[model samples]
Target: MADIEFPSVEWFQALADITKEDPTYRKFGRLNAVIVFKCGDKHISTNFDVLNIHEIREVGENARRDADFVIEMEPDVWRGMLDDIKKNGHASLDWTLNTLDLRFDEPIHRNELQDGFKADMFFRYNPSLQAFFDNAAKIPTKFVAPVA
Candidate 1:
């Protein structure tokens, strides 16, 4: 509701909070994974319970090792994407997660997926993953120079 800083737990919390009241977020299939958004050194995770975002918090760097997968991006890249979302009410074609993931040489990483099952969630729920970031457009976010 306020101007929350991007890449922080509060910002992701705001996004997760918005999805609770909006039916569009739940209309998609379940996003059953602990999705981590890593900006620079900040690691913020959103745990999805079926189609709902069950939790949002900042975790240590080891989050990548424990998470099903992590979406890692440079601070400038994140700023560009979020800025576009804010200006257009959603990410433009070029800024969408899939497009940018490829454009940046696959910023989405599958860490410690020993059984190979965990990695599938990223692709299986790719659309929902995209929607989740698109949902961030609904939050009031402010960007500043990254700390690390």
Candidate 2:
């Protein structure tokens, strides 16, 4: 199979498909959080409702406001993380979202509504989230640099 473009609908859907088949995701418990991925011009929103990851879609204009918490980063950063997962079959400790959040400046700057609880959900659900991304190792990915 050809490598899916990073940040494309096909790419996110591929990961979502993996989450559906993997039972490990079930062990994480129920989750109800809207996760936003901001890679340059692209704004992708994924709803982790109840037991499964539902509705992985793209949005226009407002991603952060629409989502519970938005993870904004350059496309290169996303590519690196995904590539690491593909190589290692999971993210190395350094590439995990929590570690990346700490390493980057203004990683998750909240706008207007300051919900610490929502932000904390990322950590609370880290294992499942990590496993979700970890499944990316099964899929081949193509890197596309974000538009400057």
Which candidate wins on TM-score?
2
**What is the TM-score (0 to 1) of candidate 1?**
0.89
User: Which candidate wins on lDDT?
Assistant: 2
Question: Model 2 reaches what TM-score against the true structure?
Answer: 0.90
lDDT of 2 by residue, 1-148 (tens): 7988887778888989888778988787788888887788887888988777778888875666777777777777787888898889999988998888788766543332678777777777878888888999988887777674
Whole-model lDDT per candidate: 0.77, 0.80
Candidate 2, poorest ten consecutive residues by summed lDDT: 105-114
Enumerate residue pairs that collide in model 2.
Answer: none
Off by over 4 Å in 2: 108-112
